[model samples]
Target: MILAAGRGMRMRPLTDTTPKPLLQLRGKPLMQWSLEALARGGFDRLVINTAWLGEQIGERFADWPQQHPGADLRFSHEGQDFGYALETAGGISRALPLLGEVFWVLAGDVYAPDFLFSRESVERFVASDRLAHLWLVPNPPHNPRGDFGITADGLALNQAEQKYTYSTIGLYHRALFEQPWCDVVPGNPQGTAVPLAPLLRKAMDAGLVSAELYTGPWTDVGTPERLAELQVD
Candidate 1:
């Protein structure tokens, strides 16, 4: 699942006319990079959640499936369904029917051209008892405090001396969005907005979440300056 429903409040004037995911990085839209990467990685079925100026997203990729051959590209229109962007967990819950028992998710607004979505990684995560496996990166200047810490055995930590930023790339099991782990109903019938961090933190406390360091070319691309930096690079 590709999360592209953010309002991109920080990316003002640019996002005023264009959704952040559609903003150009070099010559291609930022979300296109992720889409291409996923297709290359053998992930043929993709669900993109869209909200702000979502019509443009649908129109932009209308012929994507034809272009990609076997690839199945579908959209979860949160704006149309709920009238707003449901936060991470809410969006995922709403799209649960389209996802499999286990799925890969990444933020559309990030830039990680070199990242590989390997089948081997998926196999490993599927074989584990963990509910979620996140890829953590070194803290960028904008987020020095980082998001979560990793133990020597690979379990994620809620609080630790050393922490890393969550790259927003992860493998998640359906169980995380059901039962005691989460209260949001499948499809989020009420459209209650929810973030993923709290659920991750809870799972971390139960030793149900794992993570690994991702030392790769990555940028959150949350600001114009960051996008500009990528262009300069």
Candidate 2:
């Protein structure tokens, strides 16, 4: 599932007209890079949840299924009913039926042209007892503080001096978003607004989350300047 529903508040004026995911990096929509990676990684089906300017996203990528070999695109339309995005957890809950027992989640706005969505990685995650497996990257200039900490044993922790930014790409087991651990109601058929971080933190406390440090070509693409830099490079 690709989380493309964000309003891109940091992206401002540029995003006013174009959804962040639709913003181009080197003449291609940012989300398209993720699509190609998924395709190369052997993923055939994908669910993209959208809200602001979502119709445009649907229209643009509607043909991805036919364009990318073995790829099938499905949209979890949050705007049709909610008129706004159901935050990450909410959106995933709403799309659970499509996601099944476990799924890969990626942020649509990030620019990780070299990130490979490997089948072996998925198989490893699926075989683990962990509820979530996150890829953490070295802190970029914009977010120097970073997000989560990883232990020697590869467990994700909330507090640690040495932390890494979450790549926003992860393997998630459905149990992390279901009852007992999660209380956020699903957002499809109906809609709800819920953040994803708190849910992850809760799971972390239970030692249900695992993580790995990823040193790769990646950019958050959170601002117009960063987009411009990518375009220039």
Candidate 3:
């Protein structure tokens, strides 16, 4: 699932009209880069959660099935159901029906141009006992402190001396968002706003999460300047 619901407060004026994922980057809609990459990676279905000018996102990619023959698109329209975009966990909860027991998640606005969504990686994650597997990236200037710490055993820890940013790309098992950690109530259709980090931290404490450092060209296009730099490249 591509998380395209953020208000994109950081992207400001540019996002004032367009959803950040729909914003053009290097002559293509940013989310399309992920869609194309997923197709190349052997994925066939997609569930995109959208808000903040999300209609455009739907309209723009309405023809994805035609564009990529075998691939299909399904949207979890958060704006219509909840009147706004639910944060990460909420959005995922709302879309759980579309996404089965295990699924892939990626932030729509991030520009990981060379990052390949590996089928082998997904297969490995599914086979493992871990509830979630995240990809971490080196801290960017905008978020210098980073989010989580990676342990020697490849498990994600709540905190550590050397931290890395959550790449917003991961494989998740639906159970993590259900009952014990938080009452996401994925069995229902309604959603509540909730950030994903706390839930991830809760699971990490129990050693249910794993992670890997992605040493690739990753850009968080949080501002117009970063978007422009990417365009220049």
Which 10-residue window in model 1 sums to the lowest lDDT?
223-232
Off by over 4 Å in 2: 186-189
lDDT of 1 by residue, 42-157 (tens): 99999999999998999999899999999898999999998999999999999999999999999999999989999999999999999999999999999999999999999999
Model 3: per-residue lDDT, tens digit, 3-56? 999899988999999999988998899888888888888897999999888889
Candidate 3 clashing pairs, residues 3+ apart or interchain: none
Per-prediction backbone clash count: 0, 0, 0
Off by over 4 Å in 1: none
What are the Cα lDDT values of the candidates?
0.95, 0.88, 0.89
Q: Residue 89 of model 2: what lDDT? A: 87
Q: Which numbered prediction scores highest in TM-score against the true structure?
A: 1
